[model samples]
Target chain A: MFAEVLTIGDELLTGHTVDSNSAFIASKLTEQGYWVRRITTVGDDVEEIKAVVGEILARKPEVLVISGGLGPTHDDVTMLAVAEALGRKLVLCEKCLERIKAFYEKLYSEGYIDDPSLNEGRKKMAYLPEGAEPLENTGGAAPGAFIEHKGVKIFVLPGMPREMKAMLEKEVLPRLGRRKFLQRKFLAEITDESKLAPILREALERFNVRIHSSPKGFGKYIGLIIFAEDEGELEKTVEYLESRGIRLEEA
Target chain B: MFAEVLTIGDELLTGHTVDSNSAFIASKLTEQGYWVRRITTVGDDVEEIKAVVGEILARKPEVLVISGGLGPTHDDVTMLAVAEALGRKLVLCEKCLERIKAFYEKLYSEGYIDDPSLNEGRKKMAYLPEGAEPLENTGGAAPGAFIEHKGVKIFVLPGMPREMKAMLEKEVLPRLGRRKFLQRKFLAEITDESKLAPILREALERFNVRIHSSPKGFGKYIGLIIFAEDEGELEKTVEYLESRGIRLEEA
Candidate 1:
């Protein structure tokens, strides 16, 4: 199945931060046998997030993993925007509120902050789109949300890499089931680049593998990635290419 | 003015490569005073690229910078897709073809490749949309394209960072004019995270500066970025935040 990744933050748009979150999510989704079709990034504006989320839903990807904009700040409005996009209301999760309270209290005890109380901005983290399951965040204060709408599994994650990774490993991967897609990287040596194209096209026609090739440099080698469901299929594709006078080396 | 960035590559979607090109483009565009509203990454499929390009145009952004898929491979179809998106035809750019031939000859002379003659895949890089200006790629073989369609300054760039950066600096930024936006970073030392929201909100309302803040850690500091047109506006906003008892340090 195909999936999409959405990352939200004003800092991302302004070029203050490089968006490694979407790449991490895409890699994990790929490992789980999902084809990540697109990755979208938007600013912190509610309207922008809403418009993008709606558009993604209209495309109907099987899974959507959104990261960023879930924090105790004014511009962290991803939850509200996501709720609006799903035609759902923002509702408070008391359990999430309690967890947030304990999180801050532990931080205060460790002398990280002055206050342990939940203010309006902090309490805002407890609200999730109605009917969404609260995904636990082991590394941060804001709890993530998981919702299944219109056959699409939507996951809302935090901006921080540590928190997002924890939630994705603990919460997201488990829900995606046990299927896996194997991807192998290779450097294909071919002196004439034009002749390589027809061979690649033939490989696609004769095999059940997806091949993606890009020139490594202005050289004789092209980077090739073959994705297959099993090792035998991957091996057969490699053998077929090698028999066609293409030298392949693991990369 | 507002802008959008679209990066095309299958490797990006597969997470085999992280997209640092968009961030570099965003930072450069921001410095030129364009609010980058969105960054979209799609695979090397022509239809997907066309769909995303159409969507970005419908938003009416003043500038659109698309990177990647400008190579001489079968999947490098960004220029063709972009031409289709704008309802234009892909016509041969004679100058670009000459440059491509020269580039291959140079590569052959340097012993980088076995053959210097142009092939079908290499020839494809010389085509551009009808009425579009070809941007020189000093670091690669495929030349970029610059098109102005319905008030949008659309720039198609190569995926290679060196080539894209050189083309962007020499070709894209000059066309975007000289309007510059200044951005300053600070670490705002605030003990209570929630209390800093209203102060930031007030800073935005009272000044022409745009403020973005995110927690540095579960600690007493928050990362802040202030964007403005001049040094005076930026200084005034920083001073205003200080007056509200928020400690600021250059970061």
Candidate 2:
């Protein structure tokens, strides 16, 4: 299966924040046996988000995970943009409204916020695209979204790492089925960096595994990662490479 | 002016590596007054790289920065893919071959590598797309390439952070003339996060500034970043936000 990731935020485009969230999402998706083909990052404008969502849907990936721009600020226009891009209208979910109200009241009671009533910006968090299931946020006020549009599973998550990680674990992972892919990292002790290329090429033609290699340094070791659907295939590939006189140790 | 960053590597797609290089390039481009519109990450496959490169060129960005896959491994096919995408041929740079020869001999002298001979894989690093200028790699062996195609300045650099940063600062930045953009961060003391939306909207209409706000926590302060072309406009926007009763402290 193939997947795509879209991360949205002005801070990302401005380089004020490094996008570690996309890598976290991609790693989790890869573990679930989905080959994440692309990861795209854009700013918090409606037009930009809509255009990107449209382009991604045209690619027709099986799973699309989108993170960031789900807060209650003026720049948090991801939900609206996603709705418009899918040709759906933003409809208020009553249950999400109740949850957001409770979240704010709890904060106000703890003397963290000044007001408990839901203002315009707070109320905006309760709306999602039509026919979307609201994904609960355990650590924050804004709820995530899960929608299936034209056979693509789209998930919109919060920007905060804490909320995003919790929702992805409890809500997102459960929806995606349970097929796992195994990947192993190794350090190949090859003094001549260029000499391992032909051996790697031969191993790829013989094994049903995906291999990636990079020079760790000018030293005797290079980094190698082999990915396979099962442990047996992974072991076979490793054995084949070792038999070719390229010493490899688990890294 | 607008720019785009495309980072190519299989490790990034597998979530084994985080893409800090894109952010570094974005921050530098933003400082040079170019809005980095998007950042894309893909694997090392030739077809995938060619497809993505074609798409980015179709967008016609003023500048495009591509990093990674410029090594002596079998998987480092980025140069070939880029050449094919642009409908050009990979031509050998004689000076680059001489430089590569010296580099390997030095490594052999230092006992870093077993062979000093110019093998096929090592010799592959000397080829660049026809009609492109070679950018020196101060930290590594593979020389970068710079090409101007259809009004877009395309820069191809190595994936190693040390090499990429040195090339970008020395070679890439000098070619891009200096016209700076200013950005300032602040902690706006607003207990109700939603209430600051209208004030930010008003500030945007009154001043030529871009503002991004995020909730720091449920506490009194919220994070704000204001971007402008000049210092006077940035200061005016800050003063206006302060006058609207949002206490802002430089952060």
lDDT of candidate 1 over A1-251, digit per residue (tens): 78999999988898889999999999999988899999999998899999999999999999999999999888899999999999999999999999999999998898988889999989999999999999999999899999999999999999999999999999999999666678999999887556687788788888888888977666678889998888888999999999999999999
> Where is model 2 chain A poorest over a 10-residue stretch in terms of lDDT?
A177-186
| Candidate 2 lDDT by residue in tens digits, B1-251 | 78999999999998889999999999999988888899999999999999989999999999999999999999998999999999999999999999999999998898888789999898999999999899999888999999999999999999999999999999999999676577888999988778999999999999999898988777788989898887998999988988999999999
Chain A only TM-scores, each candidate in turn: 0.94, 0.96
Which stretches of model 2 miss by more than 4 angstroms? Answer: A230-233, B230-232
Each candidate's DockQ: 0.74, 0.84
lDDT score at residue B142, model 1, on the 0-100 scale: 92
Error in Å for residue B15 of model 1: 0.7
Real contacts retained, model 1: 0.77
Using DockQ as the measure, the top candidate is 2
